[model samples]
Target: MRAATKENNVRTCLACGAKSDKGALLRFAAAGTIIVPDWRGTLGGRAVYSCLTTDCVARFYTLKRFPEKFFKGTPAFAISQGEIHGWIKTQAEASLAHFLGLARKSGVLTLGQNTLADILENGGTAPTAVLLAADLADRTLREITGIVPVGTPVLRWGTKETIGASIGMRPVGVVALGRSPITDRIVHYCAIVNHFSQEH
Candidate 1:
């Protein structure tokens, strides 16, 4: 499959009809009677896209576009907005977990604080981004942030235990996602999760 980041690829949001880079939009695939978030963009079926903003997500359901646009020819069914919100949250979390696991297996992710700090300090081949545990200590967080290269994205995601488990390690305070094919997807899903968190 082609990478979603191909420059020529663009998607139109079903909710607002805004055109955006395919990578900037969230994908949803028809699943029987319900529509589900397809953050990986791998699900096979009719797909709809939406921008990353919370307004776009809210508009998607507020405008009631899913059934008409994605489930044509089937009788319309009602689903609570709260239910859809929950599904999107679940999908975002699962997508994040999956991507982190893949990065670990592909050997593109570095776990532990010192290893990441060394990579940043050495400046040989720095990671594209840093993932810190949400509960990281203030002193440690400050130290890591001080060493991270400017313009590199730093994300506070998941608990220490959650991040550690994704990489088959014990609880870790931070991880560095190196330059790799999956890095873009990792960044995208992290944004989605952040958006969801801010919304609800």
Candidate 2:
């Protein structure tokens, strides 16, 4: 049997603006109090796809687009973004943990202050996203912001131990754009990070 490639299976996440192969993303439906994928895509309803990032899940919730899209014709109860985020977090953390295991083998993964600072100074670029443990949040948030160069949209995930453990990662800081309270924030963050990172 032959394998499918990106060209033939491209899918985009409307929520977080991430693109991937169709098989690489998960689809979710808005029903009752949450946005959830049928996994089989068998459950009938309007659908949205989310990439592996918990941030993407949070984006869907904050935007409040799931129930509106999924239950448009149904008589279901209104769903909250918070509920959707919670569900996504459950999945994302697990995905992140698997990803981390792979990263560990490649020697590209970093932890602690010196490693993170180098990431900040060098402009973080790794095949996998930066994952910090939750306990480091207060210190990492400030350091990340300092090194991240202003105007880079930082997506934050507030933590609980479950989400943290699932990813084998804790909440620290993210310096990327997926969703936004305001589009301009992402735009500005991107511009500033790029501009300053180049200058330094």
Best by TM-score: 1
Quantify all predictions' global Cα lDDT against the true fold.
0.79, 0.47
Among all windows of 10 consecutive residues in model 2, the one with the lowest summed lDDT is 175-184
Measured over all alpha carbons after superposition, the RMSD of each candidate to the real structure, in angstroms, is 3.4, 10.9
List the candidates' TM-scores in order. Answer: 0.81, 0.40
Cα RMSD, model 1: 3.4
- Those runs of model 2 whose alpha carbons end farther than 4 Å from true positions after fitting are 1-7, 10-25, 28-85, 118-129, 132-140, 149-200
**Which model scores highest in lDDT?**
1
The positional error of residue 148 in candidate 2, measured at the CA in angstroms, is 3.9
Model 2's alpha-carbon lDDT is 0.47
